[model samples]
Target: MQLLILLQLTIYFALVLSIRPRQCPKGLNDANTPRCVAMDGISDVEKNECRSAKHCCIGRNGYCYALPRKVVPTIDPDKTNEEMLSDAKDIMRSIKGGARFLNIGPFPSALLPYGGEDPYPGFPRLPAFVCHKRPRFPDNCDMEDKKALRYTRNPPLNIPYCIRIPCDPDLPELDESRTKCREMPGCFFDVQLRDYRKKFGHSVMAGVPVCQLAIRNKVFLEEARKVKDKTGEWTPYLNECLLDTFDEIIRTNHEGCKTLEMLEYFKHKPKIAGWKGIKEYDCYLIAGCWMTKKCYYPVDVNNVTVSASPTEHDDKIPSALYYGRPPCQKFDDKNAKSAIESYHSCLVSGCKLDKHAQNSYYNYLFDFGKSMDPSDHWVFWRLVESGKYGAHNLDEYNLLPKHDVTVTPFSLVFNYPAKPGESNLIDELLRPGSSSLLDMIKTGSGLQVPPAHQNIRDRFLEDLQGIQTPCSTTFTSFGARPCGPPRYKPTGVPNHCPYRPIEDKDLKPLRGSFEGCCDITLCYHPKEEIPNARSGAATYYSTWSYWTECSATCGKGNKKRWRRCIGMDQSQCTGRTTENESCEIVPCSSWNKWSRWSKCSLTCNSGVSTRTRTCKPIGGFCPGPDEEIESCNSEKCKIDRLFGPWSEWKGSCNPCGKSIYRSRECEATTCNDDDLYEIQQCPTGCGTWSSWSPFGPCTWDFFFRTCQKTRTRVCNGKNGRPTECQGNSVDVAYCIC
Candidate 1:
C-alpha cells in the first residue's frame, strides 16, 4: 500500500512538470515580435502577415495565434443597471489617458479605420496558411513588456475594410456565425466596431475597458469627424494629464528626465498641441525636448472663484542638488509644522533631501514640552511608516551632523580608539553621537552561516525573510578589545542586555591595546585564547571535509579540502586545517563526423535537402550548414495553369447570411503558383443540434465546493446538424451527490 502511494506521488509530480507551457527557447526571445494590433497601420502586405483566414494574429518567436476579441466588462446578474453604469464610468475615467472618443477625420479621401486592398495586399492565396495552433496569445514575452506594450502608441487610425469571420477561441471554430454569437443577447460583439477600436485606440489601453472605447471610436468616425481630450473647452486639462504623460514617457522612453513630460504641456493644451503634439516620435527632432515645462492654464473670471489656502513653498529651487527636508522634527513658531509636512511629502513621493531638510532634522534632540518620555512628544513620531530617518542604504546617506561616523557600503561603521586599551569607556558612550563598536554584529545571521556550512541556504535563509538592516537593531552586536578586564558590568552570558563586553584576548597588550569597534557579520575573526588542556582530552572540536572537484578536468588537476577550528573564537583545533590531492579525467573536446543525408523536403523538379552532425561532448559548440537539392519529374510540361484542390468550407454558413471562401493554387510547369479565390453561399436553414454526449469527468467547483460535470455537441459538425448553430453547444450538469 505504501509503495503504491509513493508511485502515485511520483506520477502526479511528473504530470505537473510535463504540463509546463510549450514556448520558444531563450535564444529566440530577442526575435519575438510586437502585438498583432501594432500591425493595424502597416501596409496591406504587412497586415496579411498578421492575419489568419478569418482572424488577426501576431508572429511570435516560433508560433502565432489569432488576436483575442476585445473582452467587454459586464456586470454581475445581481447588480442593478445604475450601479453597473456608475461603476464603469469611474473605472474608465481613472485610466491614464482617460476614456477618449478621438473622432479624427473627414478622413483624407476613401481612407477608413481599415485601409482598402493594401491593408491585406500581400495576403497569400493559400487557404492552409492559417495560424491556430494554440487557443490563446503566445505567453513568450516578459509580462512587464507585454503590459507596457498595451499602453503604448495607438496604431494608424485607419485601414481598409475586408470581410472576416469571428475567430473567438472559446467558440471552438473560427468561422462561427453571428446569429450563433447573438444567442447570449445584449450588445453582440460587433467585429466592425472592434476593428475600428484597434485602429483608433492605443494598442493596449491602461485603464479603460474594451466596450467603452469601441463605441466612442465608432460613433465619431461613423458620423462626425473631430477629436477633443476632455470633451469640452471649459473643463481645461487636469494636472493628471501631465503626471500620466510623465509616467508613460518614463515607461516607453527612459531617456534623461523623460521627453514626455515636456510633450504633455502641448499635447494636453490646445495652444501647444497645434505643433508640439504632432507625434511623440517628432519630439526627438527638436533639441532639448526633455526640458521640463510647467503649464499655466487660461483663467476665466466667469468660471472661477478665488479662495485662500495654505501657502505652498515659494522658495527658489535650484535645478541641481536642491533637496527637501526630512519629516518628524521642528516645532517653532510660523509653519514649523509645514516644514515637517513638506519633508514628509518628499519621503512619500520619494524625493531627495535638501540642506533645509537636514537642518530641520538636526533638531532631533529638540526639547518637546516638559515630558522626557519619547512617547509623549507625538510630533517626533510623525514618521513615514515602514522607514526611518537617515540613509536607508549604506551606499547612500549623509553623515550625521557633528559626528565622527563614516558609513561604508554594505557594512556598518564602528569608531574606537587607535590603541586597544584606549577605546572609549562605556561612560563616554552614553554621551550623544558616540559611535559604539560593540553594536554592529548580526547575531541571527552570523549563527545562520556556520563555519561548517557550505550549502547555499545559510545566509540566504535570513535575507529571504526580509530583515531590516543597519545591523545594530537586528543583532545587538557588540565587541570589547584587548586582554583587559570586562568593560561595564560583567554578565553570566557572553552577549546579553545591558551587555557586558568580552575581552579580545587575541589582541596582545602590544604598545597598549589598539581599541576598535566594528561589525563582523559574514566575515569572522581569528580565535580568541583557549584554556591550556590540563588532562589532554583534545576536545575534538573540528572534523574532516570531503574533497572538492578538481581545479582542471584534462591532463592535470588538483582538489583540496579544509576544516575550520570552531573552538575559542575562529582558531585552535590543532593539526593542519587543509589537505590537497591531484586527479584528472580524459579530454572531452572532440566532435563526431557528419551523418548521411535524409529525405528531401519535396518530390518536385527541384527541392532543397540537408544533413547534420554533432559535437562529441553534448552542449559543446560545432557550426556547419550545407545544402543539397534533389531533382525528380524535372521534365517541363507546357500549361497555362494547373490548379491545386479547393480549401475546406468548415465552420462557414449561408443560413444567417454569410459567404464561405475557398481558394486553389496554380501549380504548372514553368508557371506561377498565384492563387485564385472562389466564394460560395451555402443552402439556407436554421441550424440543428446533435444529441448530448456522455458527461465528462466530475470536477470540484472550488468556489461552491460541489462536484459538477459538462457535456457538449457541435452544430454543423455533429450528427443531425444541418447548418451552423444559433445556440451554445456546451451545458453544465448538477452533481449527482
Candidate 2:
C-alpha cells in the first residue's frame, strides 16, 4: 500500500509539472538558451549574445522576474451599500443660502420725473417741439407789405415802341396801343427813364428839366427847317402844342416816375414852367409803384397840404402857382415831429394815392439829405428801396435822424465812404473838408476809367513808351479814376485839355484827348526785355554726362550713361537723359592644387589614403577634382574571443520522479555559432509499482475491485505523450470485477 501511494504521488507531481505554463531561463526566452541577463553595464553585442542564449533580459533598474498575480478585490454589493449612501448624503447637503436667494433680480426701473409722469401731454415728445420757436413777421404790415418781402420783379419790361413820336406834319397820328405798354407801365417807364437818366440826368442838378431838353432837340431841329419857309413866331406855338401833347400822352400811358414826363411838360409850359430859366424840379423819379393815402389838394391853391388847421396867414399867396416842400421834408423846428407822424399815417393808409407825388417827395428828401451828417443818412427813403418804402420802419422814432445805412446810393454818400473798389459801404465817413478832391482822385485811380477816357489818356501820352498799367475795373459815378498814359507832352509841358498833340520820336505827331496834362513820367517806363527770353521763352544751359559702372560681374553686364542737368538748369536738356549698353568682364577662374595624400587608415595592406583640392573665387565652377582617394591598408587584422563567462548552474530536472539534468549559461558572440550553455545528465530515483491482484469473490451487493500496477522511466524532457508512456510501462491499468 505504501509503494502504491508513493507511485500515485509521483504520477501526480509529474502531471503538475507537465501541465503548468513554461518559464524562460534567467537570461533568455523560451525559444532561447539562458534564463536571465543583467540589464545595465552590458554592451550591445553582449546583450545580443545573452538574448541568443535564451535568457530573459531585465530593463534598466529592474530585475527579470515572474509577473505578480493581479489579485483584484471583488466587490460585494451588500457590504458597499452603507458607504455609498453616506457619500450621497454629503453631496446633497443644503448650502448656506437657498438657490432662490442667491439668484440675480431683474433690471431696475428707469428714473422717473417728480410726479412719476412726464411734464408734456403728448407722446414721443421731440426735442424740437420743446426748444424750437415759430417765426412771425412784424405787426401793422398789410397783405402787400408782407407779400412784398418775397415778391420778385415781373418779367423784363418789353416795350417794342417809340418813346417819342417824331414831330413831323407828314407823320401819322400816334397809335397809343402800338406805341405804349400799359401792362406794368411803371416798370417799362422806369426802364426807359433810367436810360435817359444815365445819359442826361446830370442836367437835373443844374435845374434843367429833362422834358424841355426832350423837346428842344426835336423842336429846335424842326424850327430850323421851317425857317427856310419863312415861318413867323411859329417856334413858341410849336413848343406849346408839343408840351400839351406830351402831358396828355403821359396821363394816358403811365404812372409813378412816368409822370415825370408830365412834371416836365407842366414845368415847361409857356408861362408856368420856368424858374428864371428852367425849373430845377426839386424832385427825382421813383423807380417803382407807391401805395398810400391821397394828399389834400386845395382847389384855389391847387397844392397838396398836410395842414389840420389853416390860418389867414396861410392864405396870403402869390398869384403864380407854386409847389411846397415835399411832405416828407416839410418838417421844420415846430413841425418836425407832427410832420413825421402825418407822413407815417399816409404810409399805412393802404389807399392807391398818386405814386408820382410820393416818388417826388422821396427823391427830394434823398437828394437834399446826402450832404448832411453821417447819422442823417436815413433822412430820406433811399431810391434803391423804391418798391420797398415803409415796409419795415413804421415807428415815429425811426422817422427822423434815421440810419438805414444798408441803402446804396449812386451819387449820395450814405455812409462813410469805403475803400476804393469796394462794392459795399464802410463805416468811415469822409469829414466835411478833409481832402475830398484828393480822396476822390485817389479812389478814382484805383478804378478802371471809361473806355473813352482811357482812349483819350492813351492818345495824350503817345510820347510815353508803354501801355496802360493794370487798374481796378470798378467805379462809382462820383469817384472815377479816368485812365491816362502820361500827363505830359514830349516837351514836358503840363496841359489839362482834350485832344492835344503828342510828338513821337519816329512817327507823326498825334492828337489825344485827356482830362489834364499832368506829368506822367512817374507812371510809365520803357518795358524791360528778358536777357535770354524773346517773346517769353525760357532759357537753358548745357549739361554734364558720364557712364556709370557695369550692372553685372560675369557674362554680359549692362553699362549706363547717366546725364545730369548742369548748374541745376533742366530747360536746356530736352532729349533722352540716360542710355544703357552691354559689357563683359574677364572671368579668370582659378583653383588650388590637391593637398598631399593623408596617412593610410591601416599600417598593413588594403588601407586607403585621400587628398582634396578647393576652388578659388567662390562663384564659378572649378576645373579640377575637389577630393581624391587611394588605397591605404598595409596588413590584415586578427580576430579575438568574444564570449562571456558561464553563468551559475540552474536546477536539475524532477529529481524525485525521473532522472535529473543540470545546465549553466554563457554569452555567445556573432563570431561563433555555438550554444551559450551546457547541459549534463543528473542521477535520481525512479520508483516502481507492483502488479494488482485478480478479483477475489464478487460481492453480491457491490461491484468487485481490481488492483493496478505502474512502472518508472528516465525523463529525457522528451516523449511525454500517453502513447510513449504506454510503450515504456509493463502494466498500465487495473480492472474491476
Candidate 3:
C-alpha cells in the first residue's frame, strides 16, 4: 500500500512540473520564459530564456531582461546616389575577386613617434592627425575605399586586438610617446609585423594596413625558464647549464648598467620608442639579471624576493599571490576605496608599485583570464561588462585612473627568481652543530670521507699537545734513523772540471724537494774547469767553439763539427758537443745593356731616336736610366708637282704613214730640268687611183636589165671612212639583164 502511494505522488509531481508555466523575471514581460535559467540539479536543458530570445539580453547579476529596439528607415536613391552606389558595389565585388588597387593617402602615424611639431600639449595628449573626412570617427568602420565587412559573421576573424580597435592605433597622435625606429637597439628576432590587412576589407589595396607588430621579446623570457622544471626546483643539472650560459653572457656583454637617464625614462614614460628597443630592453634585463642570478622580485623591483609555484604544483601554502611585498597593505573594510585610490595614484605618479598593482594594470590591458582572487575576478568582469555595453570603446579601455602603460606577460616571467627558501639552503646547513666535520667535508666536495680519516676527530684530539716525528729523518729497516747530510754532494763523483753549456734537449727540470745538501747552492751543478786544465786526464767537458761556416751558401744551409768527453766515456756524451747552424746568402744584382736605337720617329727632317734597358732583378735599384733618347738625321720629302700643256703634235712628220715623235718641255718647283715627250701616228696623204672602167664589162640578170656605169677615187687617209667609189673600185648598175 505505501509503495502504491509513493508511485502515485511521483506521477502527480511530474504532471505539476510539466503543466507549470515558467515565471519571467520582474524586468522581463515574457509569458513562457523560465523563472530560473539554471536549476540546481533538477533540469538538463542546455539553454535558458534570455539566450533563446532574439530581443533579450542577460545582465551581470544573472538576470534576463528585454532589450529596447529602434526601427531604422530605408533610403531612396537619387541619380547621383544611384551611380555612386553602383560604383561602390563594383568596387566591393572587385575586392572580393582579389583585384587590388592603389590606396594613396597618409597612413596613421600616431603610434609612432612624431618627427614633426606637436599641435596639442597636455596630460590627455591629442591625436597627431585627425581625419577630417570622417568627422565623428578618425578610423571609421572603413579602410580606404572598402567598408569593414566580413564574408561570414558566425565565425569571426581572428584579428589582433590593436587592429580590431575602433580607432586605428596607427594614426598619428600626440597622446603618448611611442616606439620609434631610431630607438631600437637590436635586430628583430622572432618578431612579426602583420598588416592585419587580410581581415580588413580595404587591406587588398597596394599599401598594407599598418598595425602594431607582434613582438616576441617574451620568447627570450620563455627560454629563460626552460631550465626550470615542472616542480619549480632549479636542479643541479639545470644550474650547471644556467650558470655556464649566464657566465658567458656576462663575459661577452658586460654592458648591464643602463644609464640613470634611461631608467628614469622607462619608469616615467609608459610609451616605448621602438618595438626593437622594447625587445632589446627585455633581452638586456634577462641576460643581465640571469648573469648575476639576481632577478627575484615579482615586479622586478630592486631588492625583493619573488616566488611563484609552477603550474603543475598545487598551493601547498594558503596564499593568493607570492611576491616581494604583499599585493596591498592590510585594510579595514571601510577604507578600501581610499586605499585603492592611493594605490592607483601611486602607479600614476610613476612610483614603485607593489606586485598587485602592477598585475592589476596588466590585467586591465591584456587580461588572459588569469585571476588569482575574487577581487581580481571582479575587476576583470567589470571590464568585460563595460566592453559588452559599449560604454567604453577599445581605445578608451586603458584610460582608467592609472596612467597608460604597455606591458606583456613575457617580460614578467624574467623577474621570477629561484624558488623561495632554496637559495640559502647551504647557509641553513652551516649552522653550528648542524653537521659533523666529516659531513661538512663530504658535502663540500660532494665526495665520501675515506675510512682512514674516519677517526680523524679522535686522533686530532689525542695529538693536540705536539707532533713527535722528527722533520728530516726516515727509518731504515734495521731500526736505524738516518739523518740528512748538512751539505750534500751530487749522486756521482762530481764531474771533474769544466761544465758544458746546457742545450734545451739535454736539460731536465728539477724535481722533488730541495733540502739539506753539503753545497746547497750548487748541489747538482758541476764546477767550471780553469781555462787550460793542467792535467790531460781531466773529466769535465769544454765550452763550444764558434759555429763553423754554414755548409751551403743560400737557402737552408747546415754545418756540423765538434767533440767532447766526460769521465772518459767517449760514446756517452750528455750535452751538445757539436756545432750546427743554418745560413742564407743574399743574391747579387745586375743590369742588362741598352738595346739598339729605335728607328727615327718621323720620315722627314730631324726626328728623335730612343733606346731601352732593364735591370736583371726586376725590383733591384740601379744607377742608370731605363730608357734613353737622342736626335737622328732624316731626308727631306718632296711636295706635289704641276705640269704645263703640251704643244700640238708636229703635222705628219712622215708622209707615208711613218710614225713621228712629238715632245714638250714641262717645269715644276723641284722638276725644272725634267721634260715631257709623246709619240704620235702620221697622217697618210691621198693615194692615186685608176681611171673609170668600160661599160662592156657590165652583165645583166633575169631580174633587171644591165646598164654600164664605172667610177674611181683615191683614199684621203686611214682616218676617212672606206667606200668603193673612193678606193679605185668601179660602180656598176645591172638593169634587167
Candidate 4:
C-alpha cells in the first residue's frame, strides 16, 4: 500500500517518467537567457529578437559548443619541466583507481583540505594533489600519494559524480569522473576534448540520445552487480561484460532501461534511496532533525536518541552527529547536480535544491506522517507554496518555515553515522525488507526501470534542433556544453582507468600493438561458435556456443551454452549438449514461506492458528496471505495452502498468438490487469455469434416437399464494425423465404 501511494503521490514519477526529456526546472532558469520566446507559440519576431540577445536556456541550451578551457599545469609556468612533472605526478599518485599520469585531470584551482577528521573517515587523506599549495599541507618522504582528494569539500568545478557499482565506501575517488571524455555532453562520451587534444582529435557528436545513453548506464550497473556477486569485487570480467552489454543494448532495446514492459515492472521495485549529496545511499530511514546548515541524525540508528532540539556541542552524543561543514561551493556547480541526477528518484525534490537536499519538502503538497508522532495520519494535503524549494531560491531559513521540515517522510531519510556500539542503518533497513542483500543495486546506478532515468529527460536533441545553429566549435563563441554524461562509456576499463587504456588486447584495433594500454579482460569460458576442425581423436568433442542472453531483465531468467559433435558419432559430443544458468537479474515482490500456521495464535500449539507469507519489499504495506489451520492438539498438523491474487494479464493478440494471460501467487502462497488467458481460435475478424433459436417447426418446401429444420442466430458486431459480421446477422436452413 505504501508503494502504491508513493507511485501515485509522486505525480511526475507516474506521468512523466519514462520518455520525458530532462526539462530545465523553473527554479533553475536564468532570466538573462532567451526564455521570453520559450513558448512554442511565441511570435517569429520575438524568436528572432531573443536569438539576437541570447540563446534561451529554458531547459535546453540555445547554443551547442565545445570550446576548450585554457590548460593550466599543476606547477607554475615558470617552474622547471621536471618540477612540473613531479608535482603533477604527486597529484596523480594521490588518487586510487585512476592512474596518476593517465586519467587525473584539470585540478581544482585550490585543493580542499584533507578530511582526516571526518567523523567516519576512510583511509587517512593522502597528500598528492594541489595540497602542495595549502599552508602546512602534510607530506611523507618515502610516500604513498593520497592527498588532494577531499570528500569533505566541494571542488571549484563540477566533478562528475562517480557511478558506484558495488557501493564501496573507501573508493569514492575512483568513480568514473576521470574516465569520461574530457569535454562532456557536447563531446558526448565518444571523445574527451581536453584530455585527447594531442592524441585523438576532439571532433565528436552527442548524436546518441540521452535516453539511449541512460539505458547503457543501466546495463553497465546490471552487469556490475552480477560480477560483484560472483567475484566479491570489481574484475576484468565485469568490465568485459560491461562492454558486451553496451554493444548489445545499442543493437536491441530489449534490455534497455526504458522498455515498455520494464517500466511497468519496476514501478514497485524496492529501491535504495538517500538524501542528496551523501556518499552512502543505503542508510537507515529514520527520523532526524534538520537545520539550515546541518541535519542532525543519530550516530547510532538502532538506538536513535536524537531529540527535536539538539545542542550543537559535544560531538560524542548521538543527537549531535550532524554533517560537518563541507567546503563552500558556488550554487551553480554541476558536480552537485550530477550527484542529485544519479538518483533520479530524488530529482523532483532536488529541483532548485541546494548544496544539500534540506528543505526540498517545500515542493510537495501532500500530508505525511509527522516527525513527532509516527502515527500522525490525520494530516491533510497542501501544496508547499508558489516558489522553488532550494537553498539558492531562498535568502534565509525563513523562506522555509522550520515547522514545515517535519512534514514530509523525507525527514526520515538521513545518513546515520556509525559508532563502535552502533548497528549499521542499511542492515536494519534491509533486515525486514530483503530476502537477500545480493539482489539489491545502488539507487543512483541507473538500473531501476522507470524512475531510474525519469529526471534525465534532457531533451537535448529537441533543444538542439529547435535552434537552427548546431554546436560548432568557434574561436570566440563557445556553444553551450551539455551536462556531463550521466555515466562512463562502458568500454571496459579497470577501476580507475579508461577503455582505451585498460581495454582487452584482443579488442584493440591492432590487437595490443602498443603496450600498457590494453590487457586480458574477457569472459570465463570465452565461448564462441563451434570450430570447424577437431584435430586429434576419432570423434573429438565440439566446443560450446556462446551463452544466450538472459531470459528476463528483472526477476529470474536463464542462459544456456551448447556444444555439438564433431564427427558422425553423436555420442562423442559427450559430456553435455547444453548448459543452463539461472539469472535473477533483479528481484521482484515475492512471498516468503507462510509462517507456521501461527503457533502462538496457537495452531502449532494444538490450537487454531493461521499461516501467512508476506510480499517482500522495502517499502509499502504487503498484506500477507492467511489461512486458518488446525493443530489437532498435536505437535504438527496438516497446513492449508494459501494463495494470492492472479497477476496482470500478459501476451499479445493477432497472427495466431494468445491474446492475453495471467498467473496468481500460489504454492506455498498467496498473489490481471489482460485475460488471452488461451489460444483458442482467431476472432475470424468477425462479430461474436449468439445462440440460434430452436429449429423452426418442421416445414416442407412447396416444390420439393422435403421437411427442413431452420435455426436463426444473431451477429453482435462491436465498435461500429458491424460489417465485420460478414455473411449475415441471421442464418436460416431449409425454410423458403
Candidate 5:
C-alpha cells in the first residue's frame, strides 16, 4: 500500500513538471507567485485582497521600485470595521476635494437670463411703461392766461389731438357726384351778389352798373358777328365799335365791373351753357381768361384803390386808369382826367394798402393791360414785388438804391455801389465783365486801384506767372553751373571736378617702396659688366686661368680625367704609329730566328725532343685568332676577377707583358685576341697589387678644385709614382694623379 502511494505521488510529480502552471488548476502554482485567474470564480474576500495587492504593487512600482509591503501596510482584520470605513471615507473626501480644486464640477449653468414668467406681479417694468415728469411752468402763468398753453411744451400742446376717428357709417353717405359743380346752382347768382358787396363795399356797386352796359354791348357784338352773313362787312365794323365801347367801360370800372362782366358773359354765352361759371370772382380767373380770350372790357381800370378797410374807404379814388383808342387800353393813360387825378392823389398821400386789396387791384390791371402787351403783366408784377411804381400813371416808388450792378456768369446780378449803400440793375443784353472792353484796358495797364476794383484779367495772369517761370529760364541760365568750354586743368567745382589734393600723410604708398617709388624703371638702374681690379697682370692672368680651368674641367665629358690631367700633362701625348721592325713575321717552323724571338709552332716532335731550333721552314704554319687585353679588369672593362688582389702587375707601365697589364695595385687586367701584348707572368719588378697601367688609380674630382681618391693607401703614398712597388726604394702608392 505504501509503494502504491509512493507510485501515485511520483506520477503526480511528473504530471506537474510536464504541464505548465498556466495549464494547472487555479492556485496550484507556488503560493509566492501571483496567479492571474478569473475574479468571477473567486470569493469576494479574495478578490478584494487581490485588488488591494494590485493597487499596492502598482503604487510601489510607480514610486521608484519600493516593495509593496513598504508602500502599503498589511490590513488588520482584528480592528473594527468602523476604522476601515472611516479611512475609506477620508480617501473619498480627498479625491472629491482634488476634483473640486481642479474645477471638475458639473459644467456651470449658462449665464443667460432665465426664460419664465415673472414670479411677482410686474417685478421688472418695460422701458416704454416708465413715466417721465412734465416740464415746469412759469410762475406767472402768462401762457395759461392767454390760453396759449400750446407753446409751453417743446413741441406744441396737442390741444385738438387731431385724432382720426373712423367715418360714421350710421349717417347717410354723401353723393360723390355733388363734389364737382358743372353748372351754376339756382341760388349761385344771389350768393355771388351778396359776397361781392361784402368783399368790395357799396362803391363796387357803382362799377356794377357800368359793367352791365359793357356786358350788353359785348353780347350784342358777339351775337351780331355770329348771325351776320360772311359777305356783310358792316357786321365786323359794328363788332369792332361795340368791342371798343365795352373796353372804355372796363377801363373806368375795374374789380366790380370785371366780376359782373365775366358773370353776365358766361351766363349769356352759348359756349358756357353747360359749364358752371365761377361765382366768386377770383382775380386769377378774370386775369387768365380775359388775357387768353383778348376780350377787354371798356370799364376795366388800370389801377384801382387798394384800401386798408373796404367799408371805410369804399368811395376812395383809384390810383390809375386804362385808356387807349377803343378796345385795347393803354398801360399809361394819355387822356383820362379821373385816372390822372387819382394817381396824383395817391402820390401826394403816402397810404398803405392791405395785401389782399393790393393783389386784387393788380390782377384787374394785369387782365386789362396784358391784352395789349403780353409782357406787361410780368413786368408790372416784378415792379410791384420790387416796391416800385410800375404803372404809367402812378408816381415811381423808387425803393432800390442807385448803384452800378455787376452780373455773374449765373445771370444773378449783384448791385455794387458807385457810392456806398446804393445799387442799380444791369441789363441782360450787356456783356460779362471778363470780356468787356472797358474792363480789359483797366486791368492790363497795371494801374493800382481800389481793392474792389481790381479786374479779373490781371489777377488771372499774375497767378499763372507765379506758378510758372518765364520761357527764357533754363538750367544753365539759372544760377546753376554751366557745361562750358572744356577746362584746361582739373578744378574743384561742385559735382564737376570736385577732387581735393591728397596729403602725403593721409595717402599710403604701394608695396615694396620705402621712398614711395615702386615703379621698377624708376627704382632699379640698368645692369652693366663688373670690371676686374687686377687687369693685364700675372695675377689677373692666373685668376682668369683658374676660372677657365674650373669651367673646362667641370664641364661635361670625362671631367675627372680632364681635371687629373691638369698641370700633370699640360700637353697630352698623341698616339703615333711606326712600322715595328722587331715585329717580324716568320714561318711557324722557323720562328726562333731572332735573338729575342718567340716560337711559333704548328706541332711538336715526338717524346719531348730537346732541340734549339732556329727559324725553320716547316711544311705548314699556324697563327691564333685575335684576343682582348685589359690593364685593369674593372666593371668598365667587362672582365670578371681581372681587378683587385689577383692582378699580375701592380703599377702603371708604358708597355705591358704578354696578355696582361697593370690596372692598379691589388688589381689585374684581361687579354683579348687582337691585343698587342701576349699573356705572360708579370716580371719581378711589377708588384702584386691590383689596378695597374690603364687602371692606375680610381680618382674623382667633384665640384671645382676638389679631388677624391676611392682606394685606401696600402703603403705611404708618394707623388708622381705608379700604384706598385718596384724595389725597396720605390713602394707602389695609389695617388690621385
Candidate 6:
C-alpha cells in the first residue's frame, strides 16, 4: 500500500512539475529585449543628442560646442549696423594685437557667435575674454576651465599654444557653443577659416612659409650681361663674344621663322675657331656669319709681288763667253748692247783663259794633230767655241789620249847614255863565219874574251866542217839515273833508303851465282823435346795421331766436336774386353721405388693407452614396471615398471614406467582371540619400522595398507594436504600405509 502510495505521490509530483512554467526576470521575456537594455538605451540617446547638438560634455560638467556660423552685423534697438561693424573691426584689431604676444595670427572672426556684440550684456569682462588674449598661465586652470574660457583666457605664451589656437577646430566650435554646425548653412566659412589658419598659422607659429620666395634667375642673367658688356676687353667678354657668335650661327642656320625664336635656335650651337689668338675671335665671327648665310670672302690686305734684280755694275758674264765667243764690237751701241757685250767681255777675261788654252791649243792642235780627222777636229773646236769645256762640263774629255814611245832597231836602250870607254866595240863588230858556226871556235884563235873568262878552257868552242863544237865537254846532269857498280843487279825489291846517297861500298863487282836467283825458302822448329816417354807419347798423340784421328773420325763424322763425358775415366775407353760396360752405369728405370723401400716407416701411436667400462642402476634402485629408469651411459635415463597400489603411487613415472613401493616384516608373537589389529602399507619404502610393546608378548600382524595420522595436521592445502601438525603425536591409522 505504501509503495502504491509512493507511486501515486511520484506520479502526482511529476505531473505537477511538468505543468510548471520556466521562470525569468520581469520585462526580460521578450526576445527582442537587449541584454544591457538600460545601458544601450542611454548610449543611443547620448549619441543622438550629442550628434544633433554638435556638442560634448566637458568632464562631468559643461558642454563643448562646434565652431559657430559667422553672424553678420545687423541693426538693433540700441545699435546701428555701421556701429556694430565698426565694433567688430575694432574687436578684430584688438584680437590681432593680442595674438601678437602669442606669435599667432588673429583668430577668424567668423568663429564668434556674436560678431561685434557681447553675448552677455553689462557683464564685467576680463581682458582675456573681451580681447581674445593668449593664455598666460595654463597651470592655474583645469582642462575644462581652460576649454570653457579658451577665447577669453590668456594661454601660456608658446609656439605650440599659438599653433594650437590657429589650427584649433574646437575653438570655432566653442564659439558657436554647439556641435550641430557640422551641418549648418554658413559652414563654408569654416573651410576658408581652416585654409587661412593653415597658411598664416605656420608662418607665425613655426616661422615657416613666412613669405613666397622670389626667384630672379633672369635678373642675375641680365646683370651678368651688363657686367660683361662693361668690361668689353676682358677674357670673359671675349668668351661671350665667341659664344654669342656660335649661338647666332645655330639660330640662323636652323630652318625657321627669322625672329627671336630663330635667334634662340642659333644661341645653342657650338663655336669653332682655327687659331687661339685675337684672330680666333674674328674667325668665329666669320664662321657665324657664314652659318647665318650672311658671309663674304675676307679682304686680301697683303697682296703684291716683290721684284729683285742686280745692278748694271754687278752683272755676271755668260759662261760660254769665258770659254769661247765671237769677237766683241768696240761700242755696238753701249746703250743697245750693254746687257749682252758686258757679260760677253767679262766671261772672256774671267777664270776660263787657262782652260781654253790647254784644250783648244795643245790638246787638239799639236799633240793629237790629225789623229782625230779634220772633220772631227772641226766638231771638237765647235764644242770648245760653245764653252762645252767649261769647269762644270765633265762629259767633254771622257776618253783622253795616253802618250807612248818605242825604239825601232835591235839596239841597247838606256834611260841615261853610257860613257865613251864603257862600250865593248870589238864584240859588237865580230861577224859570224856561218849562219850556223861550229868549227872555227876549236882553233882558239881571234876569240875576244875577258880576263875572268881566260881560265874556262872547257867552254872554248872549235870549228869543224863548218860546225862549231866545244873542245872539252863539261856535262851538268840533273834528274838522271846514276851509274851503279858492274856486278850490281836489281833484286826486284824496293830500295830501303830511296833518299840516301849512293856510296862506293854499296857497289860491288858482278858474280855469276846470282844470275837466276828467283825463289827462297823458310823453316821453323821447336827448341826442346819431352823428358818422359809417356809424356812424349801423349805429346805425339795430341799433336799428331790423336788430332789426326780426331780430325778424321769425329770431325768427319759430325760438324760438332765430340763431347768428353764429365767425371768419367778416359782409360776406360781403352779397355780390351768384348763384354760391353759403361764407365758409370745409369739405370734405365727410375730408382725411386728401391730408394723408398730402404727408408724407415713413420706412424702415429695411440694417445690414451687404456679405457674401462662399468654399469650401475640408473636411479639408485631397480624400479618396477611403472617406474622410470635410465641407462648409465645414455643422455636420458629410463624408468622401470611401477609396482604399488593406486593410492601409494598416484602418478606414473617417466617414459621408463617405474614407481616406488613400501614393504614390511612381522615379528614373532601370540595372538589373542578377542584383540584385533589393522595393517597398512607405508607410502614409501619401509625402513626399520618399530612400535611400543604394551604387554609381555607382542602380537605382530601384516596387512596391505598405507600409514595415516588423524589429528589437525597443517600442510600445503592447495594440493588437498595438511600444512602442519597441531597435536604432539597423532594416532596412526593404517589403511594402506
Predicted model with the maximum lDDT: 1
Q: Which lDDT tens digits does candidate 4 get at residues 601-641? A: 32332444457566665322244543546545545433463
The predicted structure with the larger lDDT, 4 or 5, is 4
Q: Write the per-residue lDDT of candidate 5 for residues 1-737, one digit (tens) a residue.
A: 22322332233222222211112232222212222222232111123332322211111111110011111112223345665445434433333111001011111111111332222343332222111121111111123233333212111111000110111112212111112110111000112322443554544222111111011223333434443444342211232223222332322323534543442342211011000122222111122123233432222233221211111133332211110001111122333333333222222111222222222333333333333332333343334333233233343423433232211221221222233332222221133432332232222211222333222323323322222232111121221221111222312212321111122333332111012111111001011100000001000000000011122221232111111111112233232211111222322332443243223221112111123333335422224322222222122322333322222544344233223443322123544433332344544233343342332343433331222223222322235343444323322222222
For each of the candidates, the C-alpha root-mean-square deviation to the true structure, in angstroms, is 54.7, 74.4, 54.7, 42.5, 72.4, 80.4
lDDT tens readout by residue for model 1, 627-651: 3344544544336446545656654
Cα lDDT for residue 323, model 2? 19
Candidate 6 overall lDDT versus native: 0.23
Give the per-residue lDDT of model 3 (tens digit) for 1-737: 22322332233222222222123334332212222222221221223533543333444334343333222111122235555445444433332211011111122122112342232333242121111121111111123222222211111112212111111234422112223311111111111112222232332211211222222122222433452333453222222222222322322333223221233353321111111112333323323222233221112224111111111122231111121111111211133233333333232222233333322322332232232233333343334422321111223434543222211221221122223343332333344545543342223211222223332323222221111222112212122122212332223223221111112333332111111111111001010111100111112332222345566643467765554332332443455676666675534346698899998764444566899998766544466678999886665433443444455676553324446655543333544433576776544444445555444443433232222333443434434633222232444332212
Please estimate how well model 4 matches the true structure, expressed as its whole-model Cα lDDT. Answer: 0.28
Superposition-based RMSD of candidate 3 using all C-alpha atoms, in angstroms? 54.7
Which of the two, 3 or 5, has more TM-score? 3
lDDT to native, each model: 0.30, 0.28, 0.29, 0.28, 0.24, 0.23
- Count clashing residue pairs per candidate: 23, 37, 25, 24, 52, 79
Ranking by lDDT: 1, 3, 4, 2, 5, 6
- Give the Cα-based TM-score of candidate 4 against the true structure: 0.13
Error of 4 at 687 (Å): 99
Q: Is candidate 4 or candidate 6 better by TM-score?
A: 4
